[model samples]
Target: MVKQERAVRTRQALVRAAAELFAAHGYARASLPAISARAGVSTGALHFHFPDKDALAGEVERVAARTVRELAGRCGRSEGSALGALVTATRQLAVTLAADPVTSAGFRLGGDPARRHRAGPLDWWQAWVRETVGRAEAAGELADGVCSEGAVVAVVAATAGFETLGSRDRDWLSRERMDRFWTLLLPCLASRPPTKEPRP
Candidate 1:
């Protein structure tokens, strides 16, 4: 039991370390030795857990996807309007990307040209926006004449732009910036704008 638990901890440590390195240096540039050293684990342990750097990156992507899916699920379960939920989810995602190295790295890995077969974090987000916007449209949360595709494109594009810009300047992902984005956009997309002051 102790051995299994230690193994789990070691794996978690490796993933966290890899995420930090991958975030700092792109996937192609991040070395296994550096990751293992950062994790305080031997290179042998890293190889035992992951066959290669791609595999390690793949695990990070999986963890990131799960985190994002959970966030989206929580938003979906909200009792408020679908449009409200979508806005909330977008804010939450931006915050996560800014705060969590793993998530940020996962997005980078997903977009990496070398990983042709792997779906990136952006793809997952785009799909979520499509579904969430579709729900809002069906629920009559969208403004009259607002096309679902248009709404999806707008939201996804803005959020993605934030994510890309945040890579250079984290201020791009700030709550104030995101609030400004929603403030400008919600009225155009939603049938009725939120009455409550927007959360940061």
Candidate 2:
């Protein structure tokens, strides 16, 4: 049991270290040696846990996808309205991107030209946003003439942009900036005002 626990901790550390480097320097620039150094593990240990940089990046993406799913599920269950939940989720996502290196790295990896094509964090987020927006439409939360597909595109594009920019300047993911975005968007997107105002 102790051995298993230690192995798990080692894997976690390596993943975190790789994520930090990937987030800071992109996939092409982050090296396995640097990742191992950051994790305080030997190269042999890192190889024992992950065969290569691609494997390590895959694990980071998986962990990041799980984190996004949990965040979306939590916000969906807690909010009174679907649109309200979406607003809350977007705000939380920005905060998450700013605070969590794994998630931020996953987003960057998804868009990185150097990385091979895969359904990375952005893909997962886009799907979630689409589903949530569809639910809001079904719930009659969307304004008249507003189509679900268009809303999905808009939300996904905006959030993806924020994630990309947030990589350079965290202020792009700030609560105040997110609130401002929603304030301008909500009036046109919603049938009625959100039940809860944006959190201060």
Candidate 3:
């Protein structure tokens, strides 16, 4: 049991170290040796946990996806309406990207030209946004004449842009900025603009 626990801790450390490097430097530049060094593990230990860089990146992406899904799920369950949940989720995602290196790396990896074929974190986030927007429309939470498709596109694009920009300046992911974005947008998207802004 102790051995298994140690192995799990080692793998977690390796993933975290890789995520930090991947977020700072794109996939093409983050080296295995550096990742192992950051984790305070030998190259041989890293190889035992992950055979190659791709495998390590894949694990990072998987962890990021899980984190996003949990965020979405919590927002969905806790909010009074779909539109409200969508707003909350978007705000939380920006905060998550800024605070969590693994998630930030996963998003960056998705857009990295080096990993062109991989589905990255944005794909999953886009899908969730689309689904949530659809639900809002179905429930009459959207304003009259507001098209769900257009709303989905706008939300996804804006949130993804924030993530990309946040990579360089974390202020882009600030709560005040996100609230400003929603302040401009929510009035148009929601049937009744929420009286109280969603807290991060």
Candidate 4:
């Protein structure tokens, strides 16, 4: 049991170290030696846990994907309006990306053109938005003229834009900024009733 626990901790450390590097430096620039050094693990230990940089990155992506999936699952089960849940989820995601190097690295690494086989976090977010918005439209949460596809496009684009902008300026992920975004956007998309109180 102790051996297993130690292995798990080591693996986690390596993943976190890799995430920090990947988030700060693009995948092409992040080095395995640096990752190992950051993790405070020997190169042999890192190699034992992950065969290569791509494998380490894949693990980071997996962890990030899990975080997003959990967020989506919570929103899916929310009793509030679907649109409201989406807005909240977006804010949470932005906050996570801003504060969590692992998720941020997962997004960056997943989206890197150099990545050969890993799924992209942006694609996952876009799909979730498309599906969730469609449900909102079907539930009559949207204004009469609001096109589901159009709304999806706008929301996804805005969220992606936030991710891109937040990479350089964390202000983009601030609660105030997200609340302003939802406030301006909701009236145009929502029905007569406000979805939920804006995040403070």
Alpha-carbon lDDT, every model:
0.85, 0.90, 0.90, 0.85
Each candidate's TM vs. the true structure? Answer: 0.93, 0.96, 0.96, 0.93
Which ten-residue region of model 2 has the weakest summed lDDT? 191-200
| Superposition TM-score, candidate 4 onto the true structure | 0.93
Per-residue lDDT, model 4, residue 28, is: 82
Deviation in Å, model 2, residue 49 alpha carbon: 0.9
By TM-score, rank the candidates, best first: 2, 3, 4, 1
Per-residue lDDT over 1-200 for candidate 2, one digit per residue giving the tens place of the 0 to 100 score = 99999999999999999999998888999999999999999999999999999999999999999999999889888888889888988999999999999988888888888999788878998999999898889989999999889999989999999998988898999998998898898889999987776342
* Candidate 1 structure lDDT: 0.85
Candidate 4, residues 51-98, lDDT tens digits: the string is 999989989988988898888778667637788778878988988989
Report the C-alpha displacement of residue 26, candidate 3, in angstroms. 0.6
TM-score of the candidate numbered 1? 0.93
Which residue runs of candidate 3 sit more than 4 Å off their true CA positions? Answer: 195-197
Q: Report the poorest 10 consecutive residues by lDDT, candidate 3.
A: 191-200
Question: Candidate 1 — which residues are off by over 4 angstroms?
Answer: 194-200
Model 2 misplaced regions, further than 4 Å: 198-200
Candidate 4's displacement at residue 182, Å, is: 0.6
| Clashing pairs in model 1, backbone N/Cα/C closer than 3 A | 110-120
Q: 1-200 in candidate 1: lDDT tens per residue?
A: 99999999999999999999887887778899999999999999999999999899989989888889898888767636678778888898999999988888887777666665587677898899998889888877889999999989998888778877998899999988988888888888878765443344
lDDT of 3 at 158: 94
